[model samples]
Target: MSFKITDNTKVYIAGCGGMLGESVYQTFTDTKCTVKATDINLTAPWLSYADVSDYSEISKDIKSFAPDLIINLAALTDLEYCEKNQEQTWLYNALGPENIGLIANELDVPVVYISTAGIVDGKQDVYNDFDEVNPLSIYAKAKYHGEVFTQNHVRKFFVFRAGWMMGGGPGKDKKFVNKIYKQLKSGQKELFVVDDKLGTPTYTKSFAKGILEVVQSGLYGVYNQVCNGDCSRFDVAKEFVRLLGLEKDVKVTKVDSDYFKAEYFAPRPFSEKLVNLKLNARGLNVMPDWQEALEDYSKVFIEDLA
Candidate 1:
């Protein structure tokens, strides 16, 4: 790494409660850095209430801290919620970064914005850092706008696009893996998982550590920051059942997108397979293979199955 992230460094984490934020908070705090954590809902004593959608309030709060670096992980992540609330969605996903970018530009603070692999068209078999973005959903477009605003305003910016994140255990996990785990844990004999959609399942801790390295290495650019390999939702479900020794009881039946059409109406990219090409090229990639990471994650976060 060209630069060192020492304890003396002051970092302002805009969001810090969910699986990803919790993991990022722990990883950075392990470095003994002065991390000021904030969130829309103050989940912990260290986490102050800071609404990302409100530019004035959030900017003023961040300025009081006078951080050397700013990492904005705040966003309206619910795809359907974003689709229904377009204005609020834009405000949180795009305008929030624009606001933070403005603050960073003023204070000369470098900023890191967490984006998603969902911003692609899913037409390709796999997406790399260099692939052209074709955002298919409101959430994707808004996040892409965040990336653009950050690039336009911040002198040093790092946008890391993550894939199907699998961390936050129990109450914090709001994604696919945890959802299936919950269903099976409730004595559901059959679990219908999407087989057509393919993507990497990113472990939050791995992503946090990997992205931290890139940040410390002083590499400032857009990068695909998912786990090393790809799998379908059906594959992930099978792995979950296998890990919990419920394979015998739980039947993971493969289903297509149409199965979820009645409830999950938000338009999703057909596929979200992302490769860490840029990180690999720079020799700074530390993301583990998806299967290895999954095993590690299941040890701590069995989705309330225990």
Candidate 2:
């Protein structure tokens, strides 16, 4: 609750090309802050090449930036890929935070590390900041380690755990929401959605704004940054079809986990419904409801439906 993120306050981002990262960069930039965004892919011109797993490679530039705060947004987000490449996942998800935490120690800057809802086994109804984590996949385990490292090493940190992210519109969206849109766009008549799974689907822009506000305020700790409400994957797809006016055109069929075949290589928790209990209690809840966020997100890509 000590430092407040201000406009033109030098800031360095480690992963700014992804959906959430893009949202953060755009939102903070809109505030007229001195922002430098970096990514491994270098997909955009504003993004410079930086790998979070290797601190030595990026430590010099990061030090040179002299940022007031460093937000480490880098991670191996692909669950299946993480399962297949365990070592790489560990390096990026776990060691990545550790590497940046070390740098933050030297520079004495607070770090913002994005954790995942995957840390839990999904056996319960909803998870809070106080809930014990039981990661199922390699990605989840590594991310849990990332949170631990951040909490243990970093002098000051904000660990945000995001659930079922929705954003990155056309080309960048790789999550469940965009996946359904792509299938529908490809002229799939019947979309097989997993009804068994349940989680909160969050919009990236809303999360971006929430994180920025938190960064600017005195609240810093673990926060569940998902949209309000909870539902299954089937419900989300149905909403997509309804919002797209494709309910009449596209058929949303409910299916279990087995329907995915080999697509789900890593074992996932049956549910990952994270509640913003702490944020709400502290009056820091800034994200909107799931339905509202979905409507807004759909409006952004309404052309895709057409």
lDDT of each: 0.87, 0.88
Q: Residues 1-306, candidate 2, lDDT per residue (tens digit)?
A: 556666758889998889888898888888787999999988688999989888898798799999988988898899999989999999999998999999998999888999999899988989998999899999999999999989987888899999999988977888998888888888899999999999999899999988887887756688988999999999999998898888998889999999895898688888999999988998888989998999989875687555
Over 4 Å off, model 2: none
* Residue pairs clashing, model 2: 1-218
Tens-place lDDT digits, model 1, residues 1-306? 255789799999997777799889989999998999999867667788998878789889999999988999998888998989999999989888988888888888788899999989889899998889889999999999999888776888889999999888877888887787778667799988889989988999988998689888887898898888798989988997888878888888999999998778888887899999999999988899998988888876554555
Give the Cα-based TM-score of candidate 1 against the true structure: 0.97
**Model 1, residue 221: displacement in angstroms?**
0.6
Q: Which residue segments of model 1 deviate by more than 4 Å?
A: 302-304
Which candidate tops TM-score?
Answer: 2
**Candidate 2 residue 180 C-alpha distance from true site, Å:** 0.6
Instruction: Please provide TM-scores, in order, for all candidate models, with all chains considered together.
Output: 0.97, 0.97
